[model samples]
Target: MVDQVTSILKEYSVHTDNKMNEIVESRKRVGHLYDMMKYHLGWMDENFNLSRASGGKQLRSTMCLLSCEAISGDFNKALPAAAGLELIHNFSLIHDDIEDGDEKRRHRDTLWKVWGVPQAINTGDAMDVIANIAILSLEDTVKPKVLVSIMKVFNDMVIRLCEGQYLDMDFQTREEVTVDEYIEMISGKTAALIEASTGIGAMIATEDADIIDRFKTFGFKIGIAFQIQDDILGIWGDPATTGKSAKNDIRNKKKSLPVLYAMQTSAEKEELKNLYRKETLTEDDISRIYDILTAAGSLEYTQSMANRYKDEAMSRLEGLYPGSEPMKKLHEIGKFLVERDY
Candidate 1:
């Protein structure tokens, strides 16, 4: 799947390069800022070195093309939007890592880790600008009205992402967290952009409001399932397959789903409460905590929730009648995300 997506992106390099080159003329004075962004993007290093595969999965771009195909539209016409979605996703990641004080992503040092926080922040800001500007490329292919819809979806996605980030940070301080808030927070932080990517793809394909609505719903459910699975892996997954420490989230003091569940459980709630207030939870503490969380069925509960969302999403997609090959790919992708070991 990765290779296939890689090929599609390689085949569409003109769109990527054309748009990036176009940004140069309008973005002078901040030229070094753009250079930093490019380095982070894997185009060149800080010392002006070129490399390959520096960026991650480009999932948003895949969603864009898939959404178009599901609607029986030529994905070729949607290249600009495809690139725009990918750019937006990457822009978010660059900012998200800094905001979370995360030092690693894609098994490498984060942009902020390599550069200072201020430069990384500005670099991320430039990427955000580029993402918005890239979306405007749809102007030539679609009507002004449709363009407005595209921008609306993309803008709302960016705003909701911020709101979700705020919720995640806030959750850290509060002892109490509802399941509803977790769902809503992941929906914004992780799912919003994906939902927009697919929904915008639908927009590029047709004018059917009901179809677009369903796609938006589909994207949200997929995003939720995707995030839940990530939470699951963050705790129980093998470091090699998952590309992260087995207890990374636990070590970082993250209030993930399982941790919250354990805290709220009947059997092991007090056990969780006893250790959670420590200045720094030791490895023994983490082990004991993991035991309590598992005993409380937090792991089971999280997996079940992710499966429920996956089933719901697939159910909706099945109801949508027109199951094109691209739609099948979307279904398969969702299954892969939910069922993946890493």
Candidate 2:
């Protein structure tokens, strides 16, 4: 399934990348500002030399284009939206790294770490504007009414994404966070854009409100599952595969699902709370926390939750283009999101 999804992504990624590059490169040069954006996109090195590097999996954009292709039998009409979604996702990542104090991404120095926070913030803002511009390009391809609808969805997604980020950061300072609160945070922070991606794609392909709603729900459910998988990987993923240290989430004192569940149900809740209150944690502290979470079955609980969402997401696709290859690929992508090691 992984290989199948990889092949599907490879088929679409080239066109998506080309669209993004065209949008980025067509801009007026402004004294290394664009260079920073390019660097962050893995198109150039810090020295400003062109280089081929992994930007990311392009999951959101691929989903968007795939959704369109699944219904319309073509993805070209969705290219602008795909490019816009990818740029929006990356723009959020730049700001998120600064806010979270994460110095590394994909094994490279983060944008803020490499170029300083002020410029990085400016660069992120520029990328966001560029994303908006990319979406506006849809005016040439889609009807004005359709263009307006896509813009509404895109702007609403941006608002929800910001709200989610706020809740996530706010959770960092609070002593306690409920599972429902965590779900709300991730719904905005991680899932809103994904929902918009598929929803917008379906809009481009057809005017069937029911079909669009199904795709939106599918994206939303899978998006939630995706974040759960991410939280799992943050705590237990291999450093080599994830490009971060062991138990990096613990090192950063993140209140992810596992920690929250253990805090609520673990026999050693008091000790765990005390450990989390410390200004800093040692290797021993991290090890003990790991044991507590494991003993409390937090990992199993988290995985079960992820599977529940994944199953719900799959249900949205039943009977929709029953034998379409793109639909099958979308299913594979959903499984990959929950099962991927990194």
Top-TM-score structure, candidate number:
2
Q: Model 1, clash count?
A: 0
Clashes of each: 0, 0
Model 2 segments more than 4 A misplaced: none
Residue 150 in model 2: lDDT: 90
Model 1 lDDT per residue over 1-342, tens place: 644545554554545555554653356665477777777766766675765545665666777777887785577767777767777777888988998888877666788898899989888887888888888988888899999989999999999999998999899888788888998899999889879978898899889998888788888888899999999999988899887777878877678898887777748687677677777999999898877877888889999999999888777677554656677667767777688877
- Candidate 1 lDDT at 238 equals 89
Superposed Cα deviation of residue 22, candidate 2 (Å):
1.1
What lDDT is reached at residue 35 by model 2? 95
Worst 10 residues of 1 by lDDT: 5-14
lDDT of 2 at 70: 94
- Top lDDT prediction, candidate number: 2
Full-model lDDT, candidate 1: 0.79
Q: What stretches of model 1 exceed 4 Å from their correct place?
A: 1-30, 319-323
RMSD of 1: 2.5
